[model samples]
Target: MLLAYIDEIGQTGAFVSPTHARFSDSPAFGYGGFVIPAEAAREFGAYFNKQKRTLFKNEIPEGTDPNRWEKKGSDLLFARVSDDRPQNLRVFRSLISKLDALNGKLFYYAAEKPCGTPKETNTGPREFEAREENAMRETLNRLARHADSGKQQIMVMMDQINEKSRKQRLPVMYAHILGRATEHEDMRRIVEPPMHIDSSLSANIQFADWVCALVKRSIEYQLVPTSRYSWIPKETQLLRDKEIFTFESKLHLFHRAVDDICHSRILLEYRPVIDPLHTSTMNEENRKNLSESGKLHSVNKLEQPTNHAKAP
Candidate 1:
């Protein structure tokens, strides 16, 4: 069996730019972390717990139980994104090595937000039952593929959320876990319903938070040069690290393991491009579908939104 520990890596809501006043926090939103053998999970969790205590003793909160207390991944990344100092870098690199030793690898799948203005469809009320349902299905399809390739059952675990928010996502979960697959492979490879574990109880879950934080921050740094974090060699007060990659650009290198684990293996769902001003890249099919007058392509029969709908 394969154990996949994952957490939300980025915001799923509207993001016009890094500097957008109302919606500027993240350029992407999806899930990420690491996957390892089931038998190795306990060992990895123990290692993670030791590292968290050793590296973040001061930030572990005053009154909380050490075992139950958790360090937020965003906070850890904020403290360690600087690439000049090697201490923190060594720590993160060591963690990476630990995971690698277990045959685990980093993995992430994200939806690149439509850059520029984001607006609701001007047509009737709404076309889909849930707005981000496609994104969720895309995530599951990727997971299913990952599990199938390894020929092992994968059990996905994510950090717990609030009751109200959790309740809202239940429908999406039910559709994927209990519902059948249409057009795509049924997620029988994945042993769902996914477990939602508290980060405090599971060191692996906490480590997942860190992995996801790195992914989120790295993407932000790439999308916005002005982003305060750096995977490059530089002087930042909080965390200067000896470094993971020595090149000027580490996104390609960093994503190498990531793609092998899942990215390159993905069969993407067709999504209608929404860039009204045409500032982003478009594939050949999308370009060919464009009208002679250069307007956005109309949704054809095969291209209809219902084509991407979940199984009934």
Candidate 2:
């Protein structure tokens, strides 16, 4: 069984509109983490804890606690560590190597925020929530594909949210996308309903938090050419070389370019309708014209028109 430990970097609050109050440093929202075999869960947790202790060497800071000592991807990559960045990097690289040895793969999905209209900003909730939902759907799609192929099952373990209501709401939201009524629900090879855990106690969640932060930083760099974040490239390359990160999958459907391309290609496979009234009806005049020219074929070839108005 595959277990995907999922986490997100960035608030779900929309920051797309320049005039919006929430607009800040982050330009995109990222959801990603790591996946491993279910049987290895306990072993992975033990190994991760050992590595964390090794990095800090039990030298607990005077004021900082164990939770604060826990290595974080953002802090390791971006913040100053003992005034020696290279040394900090070495420790991080070592930790990654240990993870690489476990043969786990990284899964990520990022959605670049879209600028919204004034009306949208004031009336409807922003697109950030929708993007998050799409990312989850795509993640499940990949997991489902694996389960279908291997005849195995999977589940998602996510970091706990601060909000009590959201903690319960997220699982219900997942059900809408993965439950029996959803299209391609078979792809929800993630059999168990998703559960949330305290990152402070769960080594798996902590490790996943680091990976999610790294992916989010990398995405921020990609989306903004002039961004000054440096160490992201080096860390990103290491993850890539390990062959653990899965990039550029079908879950990037929210990208306008991808959506447009898919639309154009799918339209070619269906007959184009010139008259809306004749969409379902066979016009006698056109039928006779075709029959006279020997161009008429079996009417059974006519496919029921799909509802284009509802196309995404």
**Winning model by lDDT:** 1
- 142-171: candidate 2 lDDT, tens digit per residue: 555545556768788888877874665577
Cα distance off (Å), candidate 1, residue 303: 31
Q: Residue 199 error for model 1, in Å?
A: 1.3
Error of 1 at 220 (Å): 1.6
Query: At residue 143, what lDDT does model 2 achieve?
Result: 54
TM-score of 2: 0.67
**Each model's C-alpha lDDT?**
0.59, 0.57
Q: Distance from true position, residue 206, model 1, in Å?
A: 1.1
Clashing pairs in 1: 83-241, 84-240, 84-241, 85-240, 85-241, 86-242
RMSD of 1: 11.9
The regions of model 2 sitting more than 4 angstroms off are: 16-22, 58-69, 79-84, 115-126, 167-171, 177-185, 247-312
